[model samples]
Target chain A: MNQAGYSEETMTNVRAEKVREVARLATRTGRARSGEFLAEGPQSVREAMALHLHNAGHGGQPVVRALYATEECLDRYPEFEEMAAKASGVRTRLVSAEVLSAMADTVTPQGIVATCLIPETSLEAVAGLNPRLVAVLCRVQDPGNAGTILRAAAAAGADAVVFTSGSVDIYNPKAVRSTVGSIFHLPVITNADFGHTITTLKAQGCTVLAADGYGAADLDVLQDDSAARRNENQDKAMLEEPRLESPTVWLFGNEGQGLEEAEMARADHRVAVPLYGKVESLNVGTAATVCLYASARAQRRNCT
Target chain B: MNQAGYSEETMTNVRAEKVREVARLATRTGRARSGEFLAEGPQSVREAMALHLHNAGHGGQPVVRALYATEECLDRYPEFEEMAAKASGVRTRLVSAEVLSAMADTVTPQGIVATCLIPETSLEAVAGLNPRLVAVLCRVQDPGNAGTILRAAAAAGADAVVFTSGSVDIYNPKAVRSTVGSIFHLPVITNADFGHTITTLKAQGCTVLAADGYGAADLDVLQDDSAARRNENQDKAMLEEPRLESPTVWLFGNEGQGLEEAEMARADHRVAVPLYGKVESLNVGTAATVCLYASARAQRRNCT
Candidate 1:
């Protein structure tokens, strides 16, 4: 063994079972069985590893099961080397480029991938915690869109994210890869029953707003009202029932069908991000980001 | 075609020259040689056809060269049938599902595809139009992110979108598909020289702001300052030179590298969308939506 302690013998066999097992995480059923999902690329791997360390330090279980990287990738990201030295129970392995590619879902995995143990977080657990803001996806089919919304929610400091039944798997490889490691950052409730979720959130005094294209309440006006309430002691609470500054849940619907009338009716208010130009409608992910950030800004501005 | 004037013997040949030609549009070189790009699915085709008719009314060229659709697609969208009748120079044909799939980039092109003339709009032309808002993508290589920014820019009522040299092709099939018909909503300046584009925008009195993660100016603070000035008469213009209400240009860079030091220096103000959570950073597309919407609200609020 070299004194440098960086490179172990690089695994070159492309058809090895270990490589195949890692590659299988790309599928829903595969991940479900293993209780693990993949986080791809340097940025995502870094986040996952960091979270693992943070969790480990708090006497919590380290979620990362294993780490895979090419020799070139290890040299490029030395921070990973430092983490690997300190990481407990993380099996760090150097793999050939072909093996690394075989183990990842993306065409370009950027030479690193990590498999993380999926934590079974429940809606009941989240509701009990008094989450200020939550992002809910109902039947959002696209993995990329789902991941984008999740990432935005995390960026906006959303307390929890909920995915109703029929929604894409949050652990789907494309979704996990797309998230860039946000899956490790917050509580995610998957395969949730929408009715129970709404009821629980309501019981907790949370205002649920549907992000609809044709919603009656404009998001801008609501934000202005929230800001006015913050800037000046306006008590416009009676005029605007579901204020953006209040503890809230944003319900986003499917890409093609959008929010069904029943789903729209369920929310306390149907809030729309206004279209200022000729663009007919907002992309679901785009609308989700705008809505999440709106609440984030409103809630933060009021607190400070 | 039958007496009903539909279903012209359903084109079944997947290898026909016409099919191959349409398929070639997916490649940049092929599109460049043909001077055309493809608009797939119902939404994009509908927008393209609408623009064609609008242009034809003004003695301008009809952008749509031809449309190929399946019988089922036609049955689904009768509006396409009506548009075909109204369109002057557009050729329409019906093809089998296999043929349609072979011709387009996406597997599910929703049974329809249209080839349209690519417009050559210059930065100089856009600059002369007294545009209040512009979204500039500098070397953004991801087609999806580029399209998201374009779509959001259109939604925010940004007058034009600019793609500086070294950026991904705005007309790439994936980019066009991701734009979701916003491609036809506004002017797009492609292959623009960064220096000239900046100079032109500045000459037109556009306050150039770079959307950066490490910028000095916080977006929320600027927004609040703008809103306070709007609600009350607190003009803190001296402190914040590039007000949100001003005719402005936002410069965004590559997803991973972000704005170059030189590029960031050129901007009059470096603005950041504050991240309020454990998530370290924002996705390029998500950040674009937030920034664009911020300007949209500010510009609209001030006017009305």
Candidate 2:
């Protein structure tokens, strides 16, 4: 026991039951039953530890439960040692490279993995927060796309990200890795009811916009119209339309099948990112990022 | 044979030598020696066939050399039959699902795959085309990121996309699959000298902007300044300031290591997308898409 309360013992057995359980976390059932998830790679683990330390100081529950790293990884990231020392409550243990590899989801784990509590928030709680910008992922199946959307939402200053019941599990190791630590930056609500969530957002005075391919409203045209209106009249009413620059909750659909007719109808406006070339359409991740950033830019412009 | 000249003979044996050769195409050496690449999934194969048909009518060599599909895939996409009929030079054959799986890079082959020529072009030819908008990927490693950048560039109406030496192969099966068939929409030049390519673009009067994490200029500030300038004065000289809306080439760096210092210095302007939240940075793919779309929207506004 150093200041961080890390154990001195080294866990070298790859076949140990503890290591096997950690490896099992790579599966969906393992995560659901255990109520825990693995954050692999140095970037994710570092961010998780940092967030844990921040929350601990504020008297919140520790997000990181256990930390495992090889000697080399520990040496590469000395800040991890400082974080572990500060966390006090987290179990920090040294493990062999092979053992760490077994616990990781990627082919190359970079020798560090952390077990974290699955951060969950209720749909009502999220809506009660009065978030100006929100991202709703409906029936999004791909883990990478889900993670990338979370990252984009965080970067664009979104307050929360909501994944409906049909969406991929945000705790999936691949999805968690894709977030590149953004999973810890903001509130992410999972297994949410799509209809109820949208209704709550609408009730809270957030304009709900559905991103679709054959949308009646074009994103470029919307932006141009907003800009033109702002230039023509500086009236508050004209500037306050629930359009690009207003408080918005964007609905992004599945990869293969976009938002269904009912889902699109639930939103205040269906907006399409205009495609100028022969390429059919943008991928979900890229399309969502573009839309979020467009709203971000518009809102920022209005502010200044 | 049907009017499309598709062979009636079905390749049911997955262990055949031809099947093994096709499997080898998943490697870089195989693609280098044969100068051919595999386009998997229905989206990729469909777009390849469409491009082949278009090129054939214009007296150019067919892009798709061979096509492989299951009977179910053919039945689902009858347009493929019409495309094959028009692409008289392409060799179309029916294959079993197992044979298609063995030839595909993904676990699920989507019942169709095609071998296509690498579509080579020279630096001189690219510059001579006087392209108004382009994307230059310098030393990017991830195939998925590379493919997404190509799709974003095409969606932004870029005239061409260039991959410098040391970047991942554009024809990597994973990269091709990620492109979702944008690989067939435009010319993608690989293995070019970055320094000379920049010089040529400069000589052709195209402003080159490098996307960097640390830069003196901010993207939003640039866009705002451009908008303000256009509003203040409608002069031709002001319009030609090589801002976001002008004819330009965007240089994106690798996933882990961003653009080299030298590469950033070579650009006429080094711009950073502003970070509004706690997330450290955006991934290369998402950042590139945002930058390209920003320029696309700006240019379109100026046009109207």
Candidate 2 lDDT by residue in tens digits, B1-304: 3536687689999999888888888999999888899999889998988888777778766789898988899899888888887777888889999999988889998888899988867878878888878899999999988998899888888889999999999899989988999999988889989999999999998899999878677887777656655555646446434588778889999899999999998999888888877899999998999888878877776645
Q: What value of lDDT does candidate 2 attain over all alpha carbons?
A: 0.86
CA lDDT, candidate 1, residue B78: 86
Q: Once all C-alphas are superposed, what RMSD does model 1 give against the true structure?
A: 2.1
lDDT of 1 at B245: 86
Worst 10 residues of 1 chain A by lDDT: A1-10
Cα shift from native, residue B173, model 1 (Å): 1.2
Q: Write the per-residue lDDT of candidate 1 for residues A167-267, one digit (tens) a residue.
A: 99989988987787888889999999999999999999999999998888999999888888888874434466678988999999999999888888889
- Top of the candidates by lDDT: 1
Model 2 pairs whose backbones collide: A4-A85
| DockQ score for candidate 2 | 0.73
Query: By TM-score, how accurate is candidate 1?
Result: 0.96
Q: What is the lDDT of residue A151 in candidate 1?
A: 93
User: Residue A132 deviation, candidate 1, in Å?
Assistant: 0.4
